[model samples]
Target chain A: MYKKPSSRRIKKFYAPLNLIPILDSVFILIFYLLMSAQFVKIFEIGSDLPIMADSPPSNMKDALNLTVDVDQDEIRIFTTVNETLYKTIPLNSDGTFDLTTLTGILATLKGRYPKENAIVIRPSSLIKYDDLVKILDSVREKGSGKSSIDLFAQIIFGNLGG
Target chain B: MGLRFRGRRQKKQEFYLELNSLMDVLFILLVFLIKNYSANNLNIPENIVLPHSVASKQINQAIVIQLTSEKKLYLNDILVADLEKDKELADGNIITALYDKMVDAKQNIKYKAKTLGDIHGTDEIVNLLMDKNLPYKYIRKIMFTSQTAGFKEFKFIVEGKE
Candidate 1:
């Protein structure tokens, strides 16, 4: 017992320390961070396309460009200049969008602002895909694709699109 | 042989220390680390196979959206886009609401130029994150919608888990 107590005192005073464990812990921490981090790519939302009548105008002053708003049940085309909906077309239960009024209004706007190349399209989150496609086609046709309405155009998608 | 046996016996002094408690502590530490190993970091879906790029640069951001194999869109856990658009999927209102959110983001960028990257990160470069199965028609529709809503610089996000 006396020898055992003396040996314990010697161990407490002069025991050798091992550093391998500390080094192992450090390596593990580094590996963990690397494995847990999403370092390669980012995540993004898939946004749906929107429909509109006329192409967007470019470089225009405030309230001068045409704004097309596509709501859940209605397609509203209004002139920012006049501050009123020039045409409001509702979505048919069958899902086919007849924007004859919207087309005429867009033609009128194009004629009025012949050089205007910017048009803003704001589509609701719940508009049908086919309907949205039809609207985009109409807008492109009216713009003639000669002038890019992209100069000042804006396409706004909803929560679904975000 | 007797001398060798004596030397061996002398070297092998009968001393034992119970390391069971120390092993128990090590096991507890190992379990703790394993439990914390998975932090539920964002994972890119298997269906939305991102386009491969020579550029392996990483983009780290908080919000991420996922598009599935069937084209069902998800934002975090919210089902943003209905997969079954066969019935009727008019997304005008969706686009409008999305536009509002984007505009808010843009406003934030304008307020803090440092955060402008947030606007362009995914909005301007979307092609980087598209699966080969994605149709060109879908891409065009999104482009038209974005242009209509005033998004000049756009981003396309794809899977990146290299």
Candidate 2:
């Protein structure tokens, strides 16, 4: 006669859970995230009036564009040599300056020191921001097509009064 | 192994492992996980660097226009823009050059408009990269000039220290 096992007996041959596949999937996900993380850099600039931080700065070696102040009421345009000023122009109320033959003077200076890069525009602190923009716009517009260089590169926008 | 008669008897006994119900629960759980996976933890990088409050939005490999507090201009780290000596502003010729480049960009957009629906939109966005110490006047002038030349939208670049 054949012997039968007890009904309460448990089977030990059940299938084991395979964890290698799940772990492999997790690792792949991690690698994907790390590869996609992009590194970025950022920079900032502000709009309020500015103050010169340089103290006892030497005169610019290049020909400097300079804005002159005649009185509190008017601003002029000129270029500087050492500390001396020459060839100044009065600014209009609209900040659209009438060079008053100053362009010829500037042209002469440009010819004299053709390689100079320094150009300064000194306006009073009281000058409106809009006016300042207009003045800069006019300066930028001056060199459109004729000469390769249309404006000076190193501008010193300042006011002796400020 | 069991003998053939016992194996035949076992096969005819109507096996009830009840794996169908367990599979149904697992399938529901899997669907739930798949649905919520994106919302839970995806698209965020491991290193989260926050930019300055006013920093421009993110972009990929953009044209950088940098301005210094002293009114120095750098176009894409190249010394394309410079300040005029005796002038507190940028050289007019450089501005014209930039304007011409922008005009070309606009014309290119116009030419591509037939094939691309948003050609103008693509060119309107430029990355304005400014140093932290750069004055607001320079940026403002750039914005004004770019707008006049038809680049209305801008993305400001900021470098975060943290």
Candidate number with greatest TM-score: 1
- Best-fitting candidate, measured by lDDT? 1
Error of 1 at B58 (Å): 3.2
Q: What is the per-residue lDDT of model 2 for residues A1-162, given as tens digits with 9 covering 90 to 100? A: 877986657556656455456545655654554454334443332221223466734645553545444333454555555546574465566655564344555556666866664555555433443344334434422443444344343334343222
True contacts kept of each: 0.11, 0.14
- TM per candidate comes to 0.37, 0.35
Instruction: Give candidate 2 misplaced runs (Cα > 4 Å).
Output: A1-29, A35-162, B1-51, B54-79, B82-89, B109-113, B116-121, B158-162
Candidate 1, A1-162: lDDT as tens digits: 344456645665444445457546755765665567554444322333344448654632554456788776677876766656777887677755666656666766776666665566666645543355446445534443346332222333322234
Model 2 CAPRI rating: incorrect
i-RMS, each model, one decimal: 11.5, 12.6
lDDT of 1: 0.50
